[model samples]
Target: MDYKTYKTDDFLFDESFRQWTAGTSPEATAFWEQWLTQNPDRVHVVRQAQELVRALNDHYQDDATDARLTSELRRLVRNAAERREAEAADTPSIPLGQRISPWRWASVAAVIILLGFGLWRYGNVNRRVAAESYTHLTKTAQVSLQETVNTSDHVVNILLSDGSAVTLRPKSRLSYPAQFKATTRVVYLDGEAFFDVVKNPAKPFLIYANQTVTKVLGTTFLVRAFESEKNVIVTVRTGRVSVYTQQDFEKAQQSGLRRIQGVILTPNQQMIYNLGDHQLMKALVEKPAAIMPETVSREQVFEDAPVGKVFATIEQTYGVKLLYNDDDLSACLVNLTFTNESLLERLDVVCQTIGASYEVLDGQIVINSKGCK
Candidate 1:
């Protein structure tokens, strides 16, 4: 296959590309990585294809055969042609030349057929499983549990037995034990919710949503795991939360381990777990709030402050890491005041002042610049 000419959809339909994206074949992985490194300009298209492949794998069944799909496609075209012929016989014809040609009609029919097949391929097979998993868990639990389903259009508040609070979003469901009698407080969620958990170091709070499991001690976080969605997102507002796959969590449970090491997301960080591919990605949240708003100094006005000092102040206020060479930014100075500007906005102004640029990588900001004159 001429991969150089392949677009995102073309790559998605390729077997070798899918294998490379899933890391199933070592040779494919090496080949694609080297190809990408050599063709740097195609990085965006390749990455987009990789994400789509993962998503398609997670949502579609691989057991589908080309023969079956082809047969279905032919059947659809036949039915569509027959219906068009019947409609034409009942209607009065204006002129043969004015009517659509047979090839054009066939082209339109093919496009419609392809679109319908795409929808069928992206079926709700996994969605059904995710929706039922929460209910199944709650029913099979040994302890007495209470489930609160927010059927209303607005958010519904639920006070857990541990004094923690949950604001469940519409069409979301949360199941928790009637009492915190066990060593840990556990909850099963099928939709979305914002949690404000009380501090309890000895007994950690765990939330199971779709393929991801989140564990926290005492923090506020948001989990959006709608069954219809292809990704399970966990965004931290304050403190930290450990996010891991459900498979790993189950393995730890079977081994009788009290703790499991996973991706640690602090304040202003978010984790997205693709339900289809089981891929976990960590990045900075869309909008980062200050770690402690009250603690932020009102007089944040900086006049000719060292760029490193400005970065330090931003990091302190947001509890985020800013990576840069001290020697490189040592001579760079900034004169700016930040009152309620977002993290990215502040970075934009700083980078503009210093004739530099910034990029967010794995939830940290990396500043790139030549030494100041």
Candidate 2:
């Protein structure tokens, strides 16, 4: 609504509005907060501008930067408001309360602070904030794609139009929509990334990386699929994720994927697809941890309990499949207490007590031991 009236710089420099949005001034915050509530149409604009300011503040934490920006923003907002008033002199002035609604001064503080800085710099936050201007400028209704290439050595954070956040690893390339398609949120990656997706059940979030197609709904996960690497791996940090071959998903469109074609991974689980053989292997992550409920005490101790029961508890806590033969280890009893040690550490202790060892095979733990006589 009349976005052309204020340039990007105007929003960034407006000190009065920035104070409200930043909650630095209580009086200003209250007035602007109420004003924004009444102006739903302007919410997106305000949010974008706010994101820009936050990005700058995060990058440049100097007090001088804020002062210079505040001065520039003040000048811009004042000049623009004056010009608007002069143009509308003939019209009756709106009440002070009503004036704030039409032009939410609160969100009018974003501008081109990053004029040449670069794109989405928020640290690995999948904001999924609406970039209306970027999306609106596209000519065709076809997929409006935007590529974020992290040529630098450090990780680059990017925000998608659908509000999803992508943390692109160094030397990685990610192509995503400026605005999502109505049915699915799709992104293509050539290297590695950590994604925190915004959930929309109607539209699934899909990542097409290397030879894999990962599907999720509002989850955080990591995908590593370098061009030179032999395997494309998808690891779940939180929430469930489905991994399948791009070829398989495309082929199974008519009748849906066969049960064996895809793998669903829960937290601390990983799905690896070999590029050469196209074989998918599911397993636990390298450093597994106990995923107990909040109510369960983390410092549970075992006294005179069978070692099998201890291993079983580990399996259930971390959602891992411990492959020790129950029959072989049924006689191994142990008395130990597990406190804050990680799952791996706990396992080491248990195995030492029973004089056995373990190895991981395809995400399952295989125990090697003669029966503890």
Compose the digit string of candidate 1's lDDT tens values, residues 175-290. Answer: 88889855898899999999999999999898988867899999999999986799999999888999998767777899999777568998899999987666789999888888
- Predicted model with the maximum lDDT: 1
- Model 1 alpha-carbon miss at residue 123, Å: 15
Runs in model 2 lying further than 4 Å from the true structure: 1-142, 161-163, 254-260, 289-300, 306-309, 323-333, 354-357, 366-373
For each candidate in the order shown, give its overall lDDT on alpha carbons: 0.81, 0.73
- Over 221-323, each residue of candidate 2 has an lDDT whose tens digit, in order, gives 8999876688888988777889987656756765675553688888788998886556889988988755665413557789989988888888778777778
Q: Give residue 232's lDDT in candidate 1 (0 to 100).
A: 90
lDDT of 1 at 184: 90
